[model samples]
Target chain A: MEAIKDKKNLQVVINAGWCKSCGICIDLCPKGALGRDNRDKAVWQYPDKCIRCGLCELRCPDLAITLQEAEEEE
Target chain B: MPVKRYLRQRFFPQLWCAGCGHGQIMASLIRAIEELGLQKNNVVVVSGIGCSSRMPGYLDFHTLHTLHGRALAFATGVKMGRPELNVIVPMGDGDASAIGGNHLIHAARRNINITAIVMNNNIYGMTGGQSSPTTPVAAKSTTAPLGNIDPAFDLVELAKGAGASFVARSTTYHSKEMQNMFVKAINHKGFSFVEVLTQCPTYYGRKNEGVSPTEMMKKFATTTTSIGSPKKKENPELIERGVFVDQERTEYASSYCEMINQMRKQK
Candidate 1:
C-alpha cells in the first residue's frame, strides 16, 4: 500500500533540450513546485510539492515538460 | 471541512485538449476567486456556449449555463435580480465578440455589474474550428481553409469605445498577470471585461500556422509588448499584446441604484 502511494506520487519531467526557460511555468505554478535546473532549464525542483496543477506542462514553450501522477504499486 | 468547496462541473473533464491554454485560464480564475476570499454562495458563474462557456459548470457556485453568445444577457438579469451576488460571465471569442458581439457591446455600454472573462482562442474550438470575428486576418481555420480574409476585432478598443468601466487583455500563458487582472475585475464595482488570449491545441493547432499550445503561448508572450513605455512606437507587431488599457470610471449599476433611491426619497 505504501509502494502504491509512492508510485502514485505526482512527478514533473522536464526535457531540458526543449525548454526555453521563459519562466512562465515557474511564475504560474500555484504550489511553487518548479525551479531552474543546472543548465538554467526548467525543472521540477520539489516533486513532492507538486499539486499536479499542469501549468508547467501546459505553459512549457518547447513542449519539453510532462506531468504524471505516479500510480501506486500494489 | 473548508468553507469553500468545489462546485464546478465534474462530469466534464478539462474540456479543451491536452496542452490547451483554456485550462490554465480556468485555473487562474479559480485561484483568483480563492484569493479574493469570496463565499461560494455569494458568487455566481454564468456562461454561454463555447469551450470557455463550459467553465461555469465546473465551478462550485450558483452557475447558469445559458444560450450561445448570450451569457452577458443572462448575467445582467442575475445581477439585477440579486444585486449583491458577484456575477461572472466566462465566454469564448465567438460567443463574446462574434454571435454575442451585440450583447457584449451593450453590456459594457450599460456598465452592468458583472465580470466578463472572454477566453479568446481566436478560432471557434467547439462545433469545429470556424473562423471567428477575432481570428487574426489571414490566420487559417477549418472554415477558413485558405486563411481568414476579414480583419479581427480588437476587443480592448471595442470595450473602451463601448464605455466599459474596466477593460484589460492578457494571454493564458501569463497566468500570474491574468490572475491579477481577474482579481481586479471582481473587485471593480462595474462592468469589468478581460480578454484572455488562450490556445486551442487540437483544432486551432492543425488550422493555424502555430503547432502546439506551448508555441502559441510563447508567441503571445513574445509578440506582444507591455503597454508601458519608453513610448517609442515600435512596429505594429510589438504593439499587438499586453495590458493595453485600464481605466476607472462610473459604474452603471451603482449610479443607477443611487438615482432610483433618490427618486424614492423625494416621493
Candidate 2:
C-alpha cells in the first residue's frame, strides 16, 4: 500500500480511450480538478487543487480514471 | 486579505464523551472544507441531539444544532433556502438511521444536495448503552442485557438504494480515509452519504468488552475493511468497509435549478 504523503503531488489520470466522456468524474471531483479537454476527455487542469479524494476514480462510470501519487520527477 | 482561516466550529467543546470519535469526525470535516478552500461563511453544519450531534455548537460557521432526529429535516430546509452554501449534516447513529430514518430515506430518495455523515458507534452512547438501529446483532448493550436480537442496518446500502448519488463508509481510526470520503461527499453535487463507523468505547465498550476507547479503535481497525476493494479474504467481516458507492445520478438541487431556469426562459 502506497501512502500519500504530499497531497500536492497527487494526480488524476483519465484514459481517453476508455473514457466514455460521461463527465461523472468531472462532477464528482470536489476540488474542481477535472474539466473536459478538446477531445472531450476528463483532463486534470488544476492538479494542485486536488486533495486526492478518490471520488473521481470511485465515481467514474467506466472506471477510466486512476489516482496515483505523482512521481517526484514530475 | 480574506480571513486566513475560520474555525468552522466554535472554540468551546460541546461533546462530553471521553475519546469520542465525534470530535475527530468534526475535525476531519473542518479540514476537508479548508482543503477545498470553501469559505467558512458559506458552509453550514447542521446536527441533531446525541453526544455526537452536539458538533454544531463548536463550529464557527453557520450552524443549526436542532432537536433530536431532525437534523436532516432542517438540513433540507437549509439547502433549499441557501442553495449556494455548503450544507453538511453530522449525526449519530440513532439520530440518523433510527428516529430520523424517515427524513434520511426521503432525503436520499430526493437526492437532495446535502452531505450527511453518520457517526455509527453501534450502541447509543449518548443515553447510555442502548442498542441503536445499527447495533450489530448479539452485541451487548444496556438495553439488550442478554444480547441484541435485531440485525444491524447497513446504512451505506440503504442510502444507495434510497437514491443517494454517492455513498461511502469509513471508520474513525482511519482518519485520512475518513477525511477523503468526507471531502468527496461534500463536493458531490447531489445527495452524498458517508457512514463513519466509530467507537463508543466509554459506553459501548464497557458493556461489550470492558476495553478502553483505544482498544475499541483497534478493533475497528482490525474488524473493518475498505469498501471497493476487500483487503483480504481472511476476514470476511472486515471486508467491504471502505468507499462502497460512488456514482453520479441526477442532482436534485442542480436539476431543480435547471428546471427553474427553463421555466423562466419559457415565460
Candidate 3:
C-alpha cells in the first residue's frame, strides 16, 4: 500500500517504487513543495507551501506522484 | 486538472523507464485534452506499435492500438467512419518514419483532421536501441556501432512538405510548451502534426560518453530557436521549434462526407 498524506485536504501520495528521481517536478514546482529525501525519492518537503497548481502532478514522467483535494470529512 | 479521471489507475504506474520522456509527453497530452475539455467518449486516441504506442492503453478514451507503423491508416478509417470524433495519434520515430512513412505523407496530403503527435526519441527503444530514421548521422546505435552515416529526417520539414496544415516541434524537456503545442494542433482543423523530442535515456543515452540525460535534454532548449527567431539564421544546426505552418484548408472527412452526400442526392 502507498502512503497517502492528508495535509489539510491536500491528498498527496508518492509511489516511491516507480520514482526515478529525475528532479523535473522538483525543478518545475512553482511553490517549492517537493524535494528529494535521503532515499532519493520525491517527498513533499514544504506541504504548507503547496498551492495545488498541479504542475508536478501533470509533469511527473513516472506517474509516481499524485495530488488531489481531500474528500470532505462530513 | 482531474487527470486521474482520464487515466486508468488500475495501470497505476506506467512501464516507461524512469528518465524516459514518453511519460512526460503522455502527461502533456492528457493535460491538453483536459484543458480543451474534450470528453473521453468523443476523443479517439490511436497509436502504432512501439514503446509510445502503449499510451492509449493507460488513457481512458476510445483508443486503438494498431499494427506497427499503420496507425495513420487506422486513424484515417476512424475519421472517415465517424467524422465527429477527434482522432489523435501518438506514434514513435520508427513507427512514423520508417515503415509508416508513406501513410504519414498521404494523411498529410489528404488533410485529415487527425492530430499526429510523433514522439521522436531518435532510437528504437522497444527494439533495443537500433538506429532510426531520425537518428543523427554520428549517433551510435546497436546496428550502427561505427557511428551512423545516414542523414536524419527532419520530421517537421517532412510534414510541412507533405502538405500538413499545422506543423510544430518541441522537446519533452519543455513540458508546458509540449502541452501548448498539443492544444494548438488539436485546435487546427487539417492534418495537424507535432514532432516531440522524447529522450530514450536507457537506449538513446547509453553509447554517448560523458553526456548525461539531463545535459542532453537541456541541449534541446539551448539548441533550438523558435520559427521566427533571427538566431535560427545564426546557427544552422539549431532546431527551429515552433508552429512553422498553419493555414485554412478543407479537412478530409468533411470533404469526403460532402462528396458522399452529393452522390446520394444525385441518385
For this target, which candidate reaches the highest lDDT against the unseen true structure?
3
What order do candidates take by TM-score, descending? 3, 1, 2
lDDT of each: 0.77, 0.77, 0.87
Residue-by-residue lDDT tens digits, candidate 2, A1-74: 24556555667777676565545467546688888889877788887688788766543433345676667692
Candidate 3 per-residue lDDT, tens place, A1-74, comes to 12234335675677787788877778768788888999888898887888666677766888777776767788
Off by over 4 Å in 2: A1-74, B1-14, B228-232
In angstroms, give how far residue A30 of model 3 lies from its true place.
7.4
DockQ of every predicted complex? 0.09, 0.02, 0.40
- Note each model's CA RMSD in angstroms: 7.9, 14.4, 4.4
Cα lDDT tens digits for candidate 3, B146-174:
89999999999899999999999998778
Off by over 4 Å in 3: A1-13, A27-33, A46-55, A67-74, B209-212
In model 3, the clashing pairs are none
Across residues A1-74, which tens digit of lDDT does each residue of candidate 1 receive?
77657544756877675455656677668898889877777788877777676667645534456666545678
Q: What are the fnat scores of the candidates, in the order listed? A: 0.04, 0.00, 0.51
- Which 10 successive residues of model 2 chain B have the least lDDT summed? B1-10
CA displacement after TM-score superposition, residue B163 of candidate 1 (Å): 0.8
Could you say which candidate leads in DockQ?
A: 3
